[model samples]
Target chain A: MTPPRTPVLGRRSLLAAGAALPLLARPAIAQNSLKGTKLTILAGSWYVPENNTQLDQLAAEVSKDTGMEVRVERFAGDELGTKVASVIGTGRGADLGVGVEFDTYLYAPKLLDVTDLAEEIGKQYGGWFDVARAACMVDGRWKSLCIGQAPAAWNYRTDMFAAAGVDKFPDTFDELLVAAKKLHAKGTPIGMTLGHASGDARSTNYPVLWAFGGKEFEADGKTVAINSPETIAATEWYAECFKYMDPGVTAWLDPDNNQAFLAGKCSATINVNTIYLAARAAAPTDPVKKNIVENMNHGLWPKGPAGRYANYNINVWLPFAASPNPEGQKAFLRAWYSKNFLPNWTKTGQSYFIPTFAGFDAMDVWPDDPKLKIFRELNKLNRLAGYAGPPSPAAAEAVSKYVLVDMFAKACTGQMKPAEAVKWAERQYDQIAKKRRA
Target chain B: MSATTLPAAPARPRARRLASWLDNERTLGLLLVAPVVILLAALVAYPFFTAIRSALSDQTLADAGEFVGLDNFANLFQDDIYLRALRNTLVYTAASVVAKLVLGLALALLLNETFPFRRLVRAAVLLPWIVPTVLGTMAWLWMFNPNFSVLNWVLTNIFGLRGLPWLTDPALAMVSVITVNVWRGTPFLGITVLAALQSIPPDLYDASAIDGANKLQRFRYVTLPLVMPVLLTALVLSTIWTFSDFGVVYGLTQGGPMNATHVLATLAFRTGLTAGQIGEGAAISLTMLPLLLVLIVWQLRRIRRSAVA
Candidate 1:
């Protein structure tokens, strides 16, 4: 047993308090002293080399002000969910961790509700939440587990659009389809994805499914709504759109698919905006970006039967209750969210990702850029855009196994009908729903 | 008379002392092994307990329901989808093993030939196996895709046909996944078979040649018998690996074109991990334990019988 007359505290905190007694003493002890302090951030390739360099300088500054050190862990974004889930399931994860979109939804009972933290932070930052946290709520609790800029939706090659005689962005799915087919006929695949991978398939396909008025959940969100007629039409329509998608989509992960579009191989690709950096990186001298900045345009998602809805894959930094230093973690998060962290972090990625921070809207990260306006406007109205999360990555594997994936194969091969495929998914999901649920 | 005379000094004490000494030796041996035994027991307990508990309960991961005994398993039996997953697992195991063995042996024989850049060729063959399974499968997925697959491109444009969805068709998805396993697993099979092949004496082949034994006869007589034991071991390992494989199928097609590719292990993992139907997941995985035990027991008995013979 630890006998306690008084709690022993860190030298930093004790000194902070010791100085608090005298108003001048607090500022006298600088916060940026890197000694006796460490900050660990759980993130994906978010903090690139430049970001790290900036962060190092910031850490130096912070150490002088409050005596803290900072570091980052880079994981592949796609793998973050399962990795974090494993850690959280095992009852251990980082103090301040950024969770991917689907992972944010799959938080087990081991997680801490960041609702109060979100409210507290919201009070300080004033609407840092770019979207409603509705899709993130589980069983009546809010989750701040996700905070990404938004999903990439507008990808168009001005060079190709001009060559194809397209003047403005298509406002309807029908017009978009026509443009896509024209581009394809002109030998330009209009989009890209790795179709075999679920992440790619869902991101590229699910939006069209939703925008086309197909839903995986009923209106009340009480049951599976995937088998509806609209979903079938959506699937068929999507299958039609495949003609224009780049052939390499089957193997593409992330920005690569979009990178293909920006490479001038496709007229347009609905992909993450951060990938434009990769395209620039791949070939900075390419005439594509320069001309497109002058010619290409961005707009709200093309309308479909369900109206225009774009999927937003968000990432967030959430505090874990199991953290040994929850108070320290919370304090770090508070300091981390301030506008000071936003611009440097965004700038350091070399303009790789949009900032989810409120008031990042006016930042010159990409002002006057064609797609920034669309991204900003969409970011303002971002929604999880689904009654269900991506088939609960666990259930997704099972369903993909038992029905959906194989049925897609069959339907794509013309061995089965779209209705047959959806029916297969329903039947397979029923049994899968029973045996292995995640 | 001699016994009585010798025992007169102390027969009972000696026997008692000897017995005690023997007992101590036995206890010491057990004491030495106890930690390892306990460690193994602990290692296996959680999954066992989880499986047992889950098998009995009604799995309500999505809705969060009260425990329902035997319902999940009952549903397992009743549900054709899960039944299909089991069926696919069995098919995958049988096909993957046979394909790996045959393809591996053929490749091994080719590499066994004295050729230029033999080391380079051998290294190249093992590349897929060395590459992470998920990453390799992702490449395969790209190659098999209808829209972008180089495989489909070569098949359709070069041969003048149409694109085939290699990973989509129900039957073909199994073929695609099995083909990937074969591609990755063949290296393992080749190395094992090559080792076994290298063990045979040059003298045996010389003798067979001197006897006018044809190539076919020589292989059938000499190679088959010599490699059988090692082959069996390899077969068992590949069977287990293929049976439990999750990464390849998960990354490639995610068991799709409609669940036709799901194996038993993947099924259990998906249930327990994804659905949090902890109980059902446990049960699904547990179903394999008994069957695997039987196989292992059968192998052990065969090895014993061979030794005895």
Candidate 2:
């Protein structure tokens, strides 16, 4: 039979056999399967300029090191969740995602857990950075490694502080009130994105809870336990905290807060610190920008009885566990986590992007800068969920939707007494928890 | 001969004989329609039944949610935002339908008259309808920017009115969203009305004119009556569409400014995708189903009755 098929003895048959050999090994076939594979890195348009470029560089790095191809795609942050959901719902090409915080939490179950990859970051980056480490963990699993921290703290115009009167810094919440009043007397509004929009309130509101020693849950290092006594206080104080905000402050969200800060409409606002560098550059020539750039302070979150908690915000790059190469994904994490690689990456990102690894000297982010340097110094005291605890996404949503915020808004509007509002919020929060459990 | 008189044919047998008339044209028509009946049952009826069943079940994919009977529906009623969304959805639907009808009729009327560049103008009318919804919504958002907006720039810097937070301001956001939806939807209305307008006989309008009717009177009589059924169809379709619109609101307000602008579609999306409570979202969406069914059924009945009338 073999002799009858004499032509198969030629080099073409040998080549065919060689080609046919890999198809037989599922593992090898899976390996080769990813060679031409394209992974989408979805980013928001506001961040398109920086994020797309970084992702492109990452793809190049991955291609060079692992020879795996990748691509960077961008869309408006507003559209990312809906688009990703619709596509994924249709069983379409939703290969991977890099989303902002809300969408990340919203899509958690759908995402790949890159726990091992993040765990190995210690070997690469020489100990995961604490702030980054904390935020990236969920239920004690290192689902992601925080490549950067977007610590939300009260940024102020140091010039306004000087103009208002004496102030080194307000060390306590009470003192903050006095200082805030002085700024108001001097006619500078306090800024916050308390608007009911999804992103505006969630990212910026936690500090008020922390400052008031309130927490939805207890943090067992990384695990979040919802509903605690301190959380009630936090909710009550959150209402109080918004009292001094500028009129229509409830309408403000991240971009609105950014704009107010840019326009000098506010003496202080809490937000991610990424805008400092750009504000400085753009404000120099533009009067609006100048108001933001010169004489500003990226100070610590003002102290409450619980202590000043720079509410930590971090993002982790989680390669899917479903990746064809989990081991390869780990290798990629190792590359990302390398201590030597971080300075360049963080520097490229700029601002106080507290990198994941421990012992990273973040001073370089604001080395000589006056205001931003305060953030570098103060970032050490940053605590996760104000040290009371953090809420799982569902728990947080439960409390947020049913309780605290609505009462806080009422309290701020003077529609309800603060104490009455606090009690109402706590009761509502309890109901939300009970109902959700039910 | 009297005893031999044939007994009257049994009523049951006669009826059976009459019913066996499938060999007749009416039966042939029903036979011809049988494939469609089976097809519609397979495609539409089956899914419709399942969606209704799922709506009754409280189970969600996340919890591998266990069925809780009508518990989900009960919860849906308790939510204040859901109620607000329902109200907004109704308002939005009514507003959208009316706007589409009025704008569509106006455009159709304009296009009906002899005019220069008629073909170009007609093609241009379809531009908004043709552009993708997401893209069109985004373009509308750019125009609605609170600060640094071209619209605000014109209003504040040029016209000198104080700038309004078109999206961020709660008072204005809902109206702004409705405006954009109508802008995108009116073209479909116009195109349909124009098609309907073409179908109207020239003789009726000429007769109405000869009867001493003016443009408005002729439109009020001949034009209005002629196109009433088509307009009704368009209105019903647009109402259903606007009531469930997710993309425009998703792209524009995200049910924001304190969720004041949320409609049913956006609420469903936010709850399911953003909140990850798929069961709850499914529950919320099902609440809208009955309203849609009633509206559609009424329209169908009206369609049939009008045909007979």
Candidate 3:
């Protein structure tokens, strides 16, 4: 009679354990398959050291998740491009890494086709932005995964703007010019880098060029359209604005503007949130830095006659075709892009890296910081180096040669007239097109 | 006895042959020089030939391009940036070498005289040269910074004068880079010229004085002539180094202020490596060879002439 009363509690525990077996075995099988795999990732050292540390932590977590060993090596921003090119050429270094702007197009044939992974990421994260698609898709194939972009907004002094009778940041190019003149006359000029700076020079100049309806090439991507009236207008505007900016901006490298803004030598400059973040980090120990944190704010790029446009440096994740552990590389990227990881990574950047995923727009990354709100929608306004044209090798060459940047610089420095600068840029573009055709 | 001699005779013949070969002067010379020849082939010839081959092709970082001989060179002639770089290189080399020569000679002459702490002063003069080029360049960069320049602070605050745009202005950027180059390179010239000065017998100065030669007169006639060979060699070497100078300009200006300071080496790097146009970069580097070759040949002939005299 007692045997008839079965052990209900033991039976229930056994059934629950049986139900979880498949879920537990799935990971064990994956780990066994990738037990001996190793992946080496090369990333450019971020301006913020914390970003690099976060990447390292993520790599370690990924290594533990899948029984594959993962390593990340970082190099300076200037050297990263050369290192990536070397690895691609030799096919002996780095299984996966973050590549420079438009690298997908430059090294498309040598990259792994990650269309499936990219699509899955896009679907899971609402979708990829059009700019991301433009950057990573080459000839109808996804050559790389669009990671994020660093928006260089107008980092300015709020008190300085108010002191000059400007109650708010300029909303248009004309307003910006007036504000710049006022600020310069007050002895705190706005600085925009027009030197051969790899990042700031292009970020500022390209937006100005595109905002004025000037493009390096026509939509067809072959015909040179840089000598148009729109380009001439943009060059002329910059030349006039140059008179209001600090003359030292011509020599400003990537770091100069940040130094100038922090030193109070300039009232405003185009830069990433690093300036504001640096000020905040130092505020606790230094009274001057505290004052800077309270006074500084960031604004969207002023709208131009044609439209508002921004040229943030777009980065992508590149998996080399020659990677030995291809499966592990893809799996690591999957885990890295998962809901459990990417949101946390995005928050750590503090708007330094505005995620390209459309879904991330809903995520509360910059929760109590209103100063960083301007950068949230910056991805919507972004256009790559070759705006009207395809992001091809020729466009990349022109960009590397500083054709557009030089056009503005030549005019601003009074080395040439606006028309002459446009003409010179046109010739450079023509040469690039000819070479690409060859 | 015949059986034992037969076994040993073969070994003796081989040993005798080896010893005779070693005694041959021609064979010994060849054997001694073989290592150097192989080293040169591996280190110098291989890279040189690879650069030439790359220059001849339309290669890029991505693709191994087809042979497109002289096209990259032709493109350079048409490039305004290349033309500007050519002008900048000549200016940079000519200016740096001339400044280093004058300043270094003055330093060497001062060191030759017995002074308080002469050994200390002599060692101190080598500090710029001994410091790594990159580290020295970084210190100079801080000094030349637009906002935080100590030079500007002294000008505006201490001297009660307006601050100068040391690096922002195109002309001044060229001057700033040349200034750093001179600061770093003059010590090399000074140390070499000092060695050469020590080699000149002290009796020469006494002999010139006895002949009623004034100080300037003695320097022009005696010191100048004797120092000419070593000085010329130093000048030639300095010229080559300055012509191919990259670190100073790259570290300071990165050929900026509208490419005003872009020497050939920096421009080639930007065009070839940074732009991924490998062939064009190689072509830009090759442009330096011809000018350097002529300078070396002229210097070699002069050195030989001086030795014979």
Candidate 4:
């Protein structure tokens, strides 16, 4: 049976691979062999300043250790995706691209299989998450290495919740609704994007659907299962819940909520730690910044009808098949995954990059910070967009089209009724499934 | 004067060869235009034909798949979003074009008259045209922010008007996008119309006045008729530019509030670049080609007729 899209590579594959290739077997070629080779790695622009400095240091250290000159290039997330897509079939791009999602699946045929390297890393890091394995492994071969999974959670203002007579964050959907109404009455409102944002809409909305037991596809990952009573109920809930949100949330993009929360206009919002990190970047003595940091706190997504899940947009790094220096690229990947840099890198991420391996939990990155520790539990329950099924091309297509998020937005915005929105989404899911199967 | 012939003429070889070459007008003309012709074919024609080919195939960003033979176009007809995008493009272009023409003509008429600092005023009027489109669109994005919009502050505080959802509601989102397009595009029309206005002979206006015509009558008979040709050319070019506008709507709304503001260009970019459906994206964009061609042909014919008349 196919593995559920878990971040861990899975116990069965780990056990099978261990019997075949011993744990200590090093698949990496001689590092000194690529002394004169130069390769490039493409990544998204860093939201945190330390991330930028750390990457440069990492590249410099890699060059010093292996004598292979590694260069790093940065572009905005969407821009990087476009660049990768534009050069996919041309066999020319960065040797390795970081954080690419749907494009990784679309261009899987043009990526080098890193199954051996992945398994080796898994052995050292206490095994990969099943979702991470499902994301990178295509047709039973690993196409990319799961680098980081940014598990999204609810980041809210403590002061606002306290002022509304709520002492603790909500634990279920009903409680969240009640807290939101009280917070709205207190003048500050919650914000979960209900728009065509490039990232937030899909990342934040899918968990709400999952909370109500609405899966995009069945366990087989083949049948369309979105048109259900659960989805309709979720839609109706959004329609009412929207009344307590900022009126302008339907226009919010990825950065909009971050800006709103920082400006103190929002009581709560669903997002990763990027917003928290951005607030902390301000001068510590600054009253506004201090107030923001003191008032802000996070919670795991409220439990849904089925169970709890957070949207983990699992990011991966893949080596291009047409890379001129495969040995140099593989060496870079190994060095990047080393404990020497990985721990520091994870800390610099500031809870943004929750390590997929179990051993990473031992690192001080999450435990040291009071607020950051909560993220560990949140990331533990992270799931990919197609929660009940394996990550497939059809699932990726559904995400790219913003199918699930759009359904909720339509229902909440009065563009369509709950049932009608569900019907519309069903048709879209059918198309994606049919085209992918064909 | 007719048939007097000299008995003999001595011609140097180099001079005779030069004369022969200079006499070949057609060859020289072809040679002069060869560079431009080659450049156009390589840059414009090739990409256009490639778009057509891609539209007819199942090609994606990752792989160049087999030809699907009109399936992409057939699918677009059944796609609600594609139809909505097509409808948005037409509405956006038409609304923006008419507004630009009217406002541009008014500005041109005002600028044409001799006034204080006329030269400085003329230069300043081109500011919107001179500014980069992306930068201008970004500024507009901020101004249209739902919470802290300066426009909202002014409307509510100063003018006592209700707060407007500039980029949220479907009708208002379209209005916002079209308003920004007109703001940036009107300067192009103004400058072009101003040039045309200056070229009209002062004698024509005087002649109309002498024939017992008032200022309005003179403008209607002389200025309007004489400026018709240039105005039509500018209108056609502006229509093409506005129809393919990608950045303004993308920056301001991102075709959001449920894709209400998406035009063919944004839809195509989303489908091909973002969604990885290169073939379908190509089909959506190429649909604009035939419509634009027909518009250009019709407008050019009007310009030619006005010029001849």
Best by lDDT: 3
Report lDDT (CA) for all predictions.
0.61, 0.62, 0.85, 0.81
For each model, chain A TM-score? 0.76, 0.78, 0.93, 0.91
Write model 4 residue lDDT over A140-244, tens digit each, in one string: 888999888777788999989999998999999999999999999999999988767877887789888988989899888878999999989888888889889
Give the better candidate number (2 or 3) by DockQ: 3
Better of 1 and 3 by lDDT: 3
TM-scores for all candidates? 0.78, 0.77, 0.93, 0.91
- List of clashing residue pairs for candidate 2: A129-A356, A129-A357, A214-A230, A215-A231, A216-A227, A217-A225, A283-A289, A283-A290
TM-score of 1: 0.78
Per-residue C-alpha lDDT of model 3 across residues A94-201, encoded as one tens digit per residue: 899898666898788889999987887798778998888898999898999977898889999999989988899998999999999999889889999988888898
B-chain TM-scores per prediction: 0.84, 0.85, 0.95, 0.90
- Model 4 chain B: weakest 10-residue lDDT segment is B1-10
lDDT of 3 at A165: 85
**Candidate 2 lDDT over residue span B1-309, tens digit each:** 465545654677787877787658888899899999999999989867765666666433323456668877787676666787888888878887787888988988888888899999999989988999989987886777543567877888888897777775666778888898889999888888889999988899889888999988988889998888888898888888887888887777666655567788877766666655666777788888888998899999998998899
Best by TM-score: 3
